[model samples]
Target: MRSVSIPDAVRCKVAAEPRVDAPHHPITLSFTDGVLTMEGELADLAAKKLALERAASVPGVDHIVDRLRVAPARTMGDAEIRDHVRDLLLEEPVLQPLARATPSLEPGVPLRPDVVLGTIGLSVARGVVTLDGIVPSLAHKRLAGALAWWVPGVRDVVNGLEVVPPEEDDDGEISDAVRLVLEKDPLVDASQLGVSTRRAVVTLSGVVRCGVERRAAERDAWCVFGVDGVTNHIEVRE
Candidate 1:
């Protein structure tokens, strides 16, 4: 295969992307044979993903090597991280409605904001945040997880949100939705996977090339509405 040299125009375009622009991100870009290598330290996983996505958008870039490190603004204890996550969730407009949902209270009983927010269970262990609750829509579930990632010192996020849509989904509908998502994802090979849904619980069984692809498949399943839980039994060949 012939190697494609990196063009100056492509480099400039990639460098100017708002996600990786300097002063805040300060990433080092290199290219060879249509492969772009991004190396730097960012605040969180979302920024790293954004930078890689932007780099891949540049024309002529065929593959990306992500070497970006997650360096939080400052080191924080687990307790502090949990507090920060709560604050962010409460402040987020998309999640405030859920966070401020008024729970059933006795007559003349003053509302407890903390109890309402507690419905969205949050637990942090070594920077890994676990969110547990039932949300009204898939959008709310996803938004809450994204907001958790934005919190400083959040190394990773586990979104355990159950979506309770207005209309309940049957097992067949959910299974079809998961399969469609897997087929549409560029990284997942739907042919090598098996998807099944029972009582809103999805089970994936198959082989993938790597752990990244396996995780990608699971994420796609989660994206489908009405999926109460995911059981990823996909084996990684490599």
Candidate 2:
């Protein structure tokens, strides 16, 4: 028979995973005679369901004794949960635009006066923000809403952001712009793709066969407008 001992570092790592704010029951870890047992109460149903999963994720635990119970839902109302979520949502960068726009969501659009936030194109009216233009994903839309609500004068967010796929034309522009970048550097094959730019947004397309080539194309696009950023949709093929 073999005996096993738990290291303090490993124990500390486990404790840190579920923050103290998380509902937790007693958790016991033992490694004697080659066996490990874990017991704990989790904050709620979700935590209890996830306890075994968390245990399995740890590296050296060979066995577990999961007797953790899922506590009933806390008395805190839905409004409280929503408030907490709202605070968290406002903390993200993507949502900040919404907060800036919220005051002008109506009344023919109050122009965003700040250039940095204005680049995102936020408008406010009355007390809500009416979002416009394109967003890459649903996540951005939600962030916009959170930001609108976070503003002092904001009442709500009007999400008008359209989810559009990066345009094929944009790809062509990207490729061409990348080609230009390569040409200027004298270190890359500039003829591989046709690239172009609009409003500091570089678009790339065409065939880049390797990761290195693709990255190079992207780097070129980025150099043109250091602050505006690049969109690389170059296809990789052999």
Candidate 3:
């Protein structure tokens, strides 16, 4: 008897994830051999990551083709997005050394890259930003991806930044990205916001003038690349 039990099992596991199956999310799953293809719009970045994690946990699911998406902040051309990402990477004080190794946006050539750790190769095609290179730490890798995602026009981020020392990725990286997200958004006052992440779950606290600001702060938290969950603790004073 021909069997198709693996896909069924994977489906069950995926459905079991509340966030994946949430009313706001529309996910479509397909399986072929050991590869699972997940495509659709999740409520936010956390939901998208959680959905992929859920599908990969299934026994026979060896490779996952993630086509998940979150509602984009805005839309722009590839060139503009690439420039924004490049500028952010260069402007970040912590990432300055790594950014020096990044290729220049004008002619798509490396400008004295290979300075500190290794070179960062960047490209944007159809709103997807691909970053491939080596960084000194896992935090640097995550920070670069978060910056790419921070761009309003970026639809997806392919973070291939290898940590040379192979440090373990932890909650600290998530908190750092969350803090950067808050700081980048003009509507939210980062000083008034308390940012924290534990095991990939983000907790946004503090008070804002209106419910809109509060919601914006929470949404900012969800926009980071590696976030798994967001708990909004923001209060609206007005």
Candidate 4:
């Protein structure tokens, strides 16, 4: 069986999900030879005990990688602090919305799975969201950032998502006319050029040999979009 490595981009989704946090830290999942392993860590004995119970609930896990180190038992005074903190996270409406949306949100794509949308991890007093895990792409990273901004009470997002570059598709092709125009233009370096369309708005980026080449690429792209402006960010190369 082939194993898929979890990308950094998906970490954001993991951090945001309430089910995953469950007091378990650094949950690692791996499947090979028809066997699966799940590992967890926690800050203290109570958390470790809670995490083990939660880990037992996860489906499709064949093995448990237990690395939890038991911390000194918390005093009643400390437990009181924990309760207060938990209450603050639960009361925040924005965090609650995320806590609600995350449970049902589709895994990956438009939104990645590792992004934790819940309030449990958000430090409302400090106005910072502590996120973990990986994202599949920079676009998803940007998407996660945008989602964080939408939350009502959130003043700032502390992004901790690792960016995972998408797999390259080298068999990509461009229209013959566009390719010809790019190749014939002496000012433009066709090799570094990239063309993409969204709602028919053409975007072009890459390195140009000089300023004239950059402008030339823009003109060529304009022909494709046909009167629509092109977002040309062609850098001048020495």
Q: What local distance difference test score does each model get?
A: 0.69, 0.47, 0.75, 0.44
Cα lDDT tens digits for candidate 1, 146-173: 5665565766667777777654447886
Colliding residue pairs in candidate 1: none
For candidate 3, the TM-score is: 0.75
Candidate 4 Cα RMSD (Å): 19.5
Model 2, C-alpha of 194: deviation from truth (Å): 2.0
Instruction: Summarize candidate 2's per-residue lDDT along 1-238 as a digit string, tens digits.
Output: 8543353433554566563223235565656553556555555333333444455556676666544443323433323333333443445565555434344433455333311232244444433345566666444543444344333344334556654664333444443434534554433466676565664455666776687877766644543311143556778786
- For residues 1-238, could you state the per-residue lDDT of candidate 3 as single tens digits? 9776866776677677786665556677788888888877765566677777777778888999988776667879877787778888878887888777422333565433212223677877777888887888766776778778778887778888888988766788788768876776778888888888887888988888998788778767766667777899888887
lDDT score for candidate 4 against the true structure? 0.44
- Looking at model 2, residue 175 earns an lDDT score of 39
Q: Stretches of candidate 1 above 4 Å error?
A: 1-71, 101-118, 166-238
Native-vs-model 1 lDDT? 0.69
TM-scores for all predictions: 0.38, 0.25, 0.75, 0.25
* After superposition, candidate 4 runs with Cα above 4 Å error: 1-177, 225-227
Report clashes for each candidate as comma-separated counts. 0, 22, 1, 21
lDDT of model 4 at position 83: 32
Give the lDDT of residue 93 in candidate 4: 41
